[model samples]
Structures are given as C-alpha cells and as structure tokens.
Target: MTKELLLAAFIISVGLCVAGAGTHFYQWRLRQQAMLRYDGATVFASMGNLVMSFFCGPYIMLQMGWSQEGGASVNMGSALLSALVAFGWAFLTGLLIVGLYVAVRS
Candidate 1:
C-alpha cells in the first residue's frame, strides 16, 4: 500500500483504540463512583460520549481543512461521510470492549 494509505489507516486505528479505552475507563469510573455493579445506562452513556468524541476529533480535523495530502480542501460531503464512519467504528469498538468485559466478569 501507499504511504498515505498506511498513514491514514494507522491514524484511524489509533483513534478507534483510544476511543475504546476511553469508554472502558469512563465506565470504570462511573462504577467506582456509584459503588455499584455496572448497568446498562452507565454503559450507554459511556459509549455515547466515546463515539461522539471519536467523530468530533475527525470532524474538527476536517473543519480545519486538514487532509491526508497535507493541503486545505473543504469537501463537506466527504467530511460528513468520514465523520459518520468514524463514529460507527468507535461505537462498535466501544460496544465490543464492553461486551468482552461483561463476558469476563460473568
């Protein structure tokens, strides 16, 4: 693959992993604060924030005209699609991590 593609993939992977870790940490914090077992509402809130941040990061990048080619290009349609994809990936990653944690705890 091209260097640009590799770089893009690496960045996106890192973003998703960070988002998942953030969700896990947030859930843990909530559980600690409440001094109770993990619940659906807490998980949902954590996941929602995680996904929002994930998309927001990329959205901001797009807004600032940050492109893989290192040039300023405003493509609203493409940026919106990218934001949606990032959000979905982050949401899925968070859900998978939470599911695994619940599975292990059970």
Candidate 2:
C-alpha cells in the first residue's frame, strides 16, 4: 500500500514538473524571439522551482497518509490541496522571475 502511494505520488509529481517545464520553455521561446537579449537564467530558475515543487508536493502529500488495519489510504483532498499549494508556489516563483527579468531588462 505504501509502495502504491509512493508510485502514485511520483507519477503526479512528474506530470506536474513536465507541465511546468513545458510552459516555462514556451515562455522562454517567445521572449527569445521578441527581445534582443533575454535572460536565459529566468527560465532555468523557474524550472528549478518546478523541480523543487515536484519533490515538495509529493512529500507533503505523503505525510498526510493514514494507516489502517487492512490497507493504507490517503485523502484525495489532501493530495489535491498539496498539488495546488505546490503549483501556487511555482507560479509565484515564475512571477518573481518575470519581475526580475523586467528589472534587469530596463
């Protein structure tokens, strides 16, 4: 049961990370074409935050699991909540990156 939960969390984290990375990369491409000198580090920093969130979200969710007599189960709400929180954190980090980009650009 623990193994199943771990597997599920890992899969979820990977999905989130992939989605986040793709989005960041797309943004980078757009910026690269529009601006003469865009900081590549912004995209890398956002990706790093996404990676951190991938690990963080699952770890938080895993802690919310409860053990029972026959099997172990985790609350669906908790999992979603953790994912939301992690995504929010990453989003905020992305925003910060954007702000930094703007600051440096000017």
Candidate 2 residues 1-106, lDDT tens each?
A: 9997675555555545544565456457655311113234689866655554443333333333332223466566666676676555444454445556679999
TM-score of each: 0.36, 0.33
Evaluated against the true structure, the overall lDDT of model 2 is 0.49
Per-model lDDT:
0.52, 0.49
Clash count, candidate 2: 0
RMSD values for the candidates in order, in angstroms, are 13.0, 15.6
For model 1 the TM-score comes to: 0.36
What ranges in model 2 sit over 4 Å off? 1-74
lDDT tens digits, residues 1-106, model 1?
A: 6997665555556556665455456557656322112234687866655554553343333333324433555566666776676655645554555556679999
TM-score of 2: 0.33
